[model samples]
Target: MENKNLVDDCLFCKIIRGEVPSYTVFENDDVKAFLDISQVNPGHTLMIPKKHITNLFDYTKEDVQRYLQYIPEIANAIKKAFPNVTGMNITTNNGKSANQVVMHSHIHFIPRFKGDGLKLMTRNNADQYDEAKYNEVADKIKAQF
Candidate 1:
């Protein structure tokens, strides 16, 4: 049975159910890893929970831990399968504000090399390291924890 969040319309859910085509690399009861169609790099892949959840904020502690615990094994498999993967980047975009296109929460496993010409970051001119502000923000987040 599907939860209200796991609609047929959700792309990841369709892939999980084999209703849509995907280059599936790994799957367990709780998660699935597949080659990303967009292929940000030659071996870019995605790991997602089999159950649909909108974003990181929607994950329960158990859900998050269970899915994340499999990442290292999945990442190692990707590294072994892809050539010249000197490094990897595990990224998750959380919300619309973070440019999350897919509603389902997923981690991007981007294989990196010495000169792949891929860059995950740019200088944020407005970003500043303010000690006082850092402490204040840390305290607020700590409260939630």
Candidate 2:
């Protein structure tokens, strides 16, 4: 099945087209999973849609369903493959400001162990928001739905 969303010059698109090599771990019609070259941890894997949608904001409901369905199975396989893994981080950055360097929408599955020293999402500003502030923000987001 040809991916209608393929972007000609995108690195991931090249990988998908076999124009570039990748350490591919999983692939189906709609998605591909591969080892991240910059392995933050030993088994860091990336899962990307075969479609070249740039980020979360670009995904349609059908795109989400098609691309996200493989996550759990892949995560479980990563955990099982690395016996020392005690937990994992499943995350995606939506834009350049959020550290999305590739521009192709992808999810990172980084296998974690104790003292892995990978500090993620450390800055917490929970105390800055009171109940009313929380409710106000929630209402604004809920309105979009």
- For each candidate in turn, give its C-alpha RMSD to the true structure in angstroms: 2.3, 1.3
Residue ranges of candidate 1 with Cα displaced over 4 Å? 1-5, 124-127
Tens digits of per-residue lDDT, candidate 2, 1-145, equal 5667798889999899988999999998889999999999998999999989899999999998989999999999999999999999999999999999998999999999999998887687899999999999999999998
lDDT of 2 at 132: 98
User: What is the clash count for each candidate, in the order shown?
Assistant: 0, 0
- Each candidate structure's TM-score, on Cα atoms with residue i matched to residue i, is 0.87, 0.94
Name the 10 consecutive residues with the lowest summed lDDT in model 2.
Answer: 1-10
Lowest-sum lDDT 10-residue window in model 1: 120-129
> Of the candidates shown, which would achieve the greatest TM-score relative to the real structure?
2
lDDT tens digits, residues 1-145, model 1? 6545467889999888788999988888889899999999887889999889898999889997888899899889888987679999999999998989999999999999888898777586446758888898899999996
